[model samples]
Target: MGIKLDEEKGLTLLEVLLSIVLLVIILTSFASFFTQSAMFVKKNEDKLSTTQTAQQIVNQIEVSLSKNDVKTSSVCGTLPCLLEKKELSNLLGSPITSSFNISAKFADSVEGLIRVKVSVTDIKNPENSSETFTYIRR
Candidate 1:
């Protein structure tokens, strides 16, 4: 009877250890899944923000071109030029808090056509960045 009781106690100990191991495995998998899901959400948000910034820059370029005031000498510098980042931000009624670099150059193929490039870094995430390049003709 004593030996039989000892065998039953040992079996119970083994069952407890196996239960703990199974629980650990399950919890680890859940943690991995949550981490991956969070990363995916963050990537998607960055992409959306980049697209929005590109669209806003393109619109500003179009408006500047429509005014027909952009100077041949102001391709981006030295003269009454199409709007720079600061000017565009002001025109768009947004604060110029973002680090945006804007450049304009005359297009090689078309007279009175300008190529504009806007590079901006996300305010919330400086490491992630985007660029918009567009052509505008007077």
Candidate 2:
């Protein structure tokens, strides 16, 4: 017998096209979300790296101060001790590019207490920066 007119079971061409369009829209939104997530992860990683570098510098300063006074220590011989980009690279034993900056300073208001401020900044992205403040006895 011939096929009946009302017995068709397959999807229509228009329905298939509409489904494909919906699928494309969903996939595009997911792609955008993934891209944004990746960017956020990268920024956070930069922040963590800068923070760890700054902390390492502060630790080194603390250790040096423990062994010797700030005025006579190799790390810093004056109240406002600053390390150039090259020096920072040398100190870390790695190539710290010009995109990064590090600084250390002391507070003058307190006696017998040296307030050490260490800051590391990413030149490319100013928002990605880390600073550590420590108080050590001189």
- The global C-alpha lDDT for each of the candidates, from Candidate 1 onward, is 0.61, 0.73
Off by over 4 Å in 2: 1-7, 73-76, 85-99, 109-111
Error of 2 at 20 (Å): 0.1
Error of 1 at 123 (Å): 3.8
Error of 1 at 125 (Å): 3.2
Candidate 2 C-alpha error for residue 119, in Å: 0.9
Predicted model with the maximum TM-score: 2
Model 2 pairs whose backbones collide: none
lDDT (10s digit) by residue, model 2, range 22-135: 999999999999999999999899999899888887777676554136555555556666666565444444554435787766553466677878889988888889999898
lDDT of 1 by residue, 13-107 (tens): 78899999999999999999999999999988886777677667777668655434444233343333455566656454554554544433323
Against the true structure, whose lDDT is highest?
2
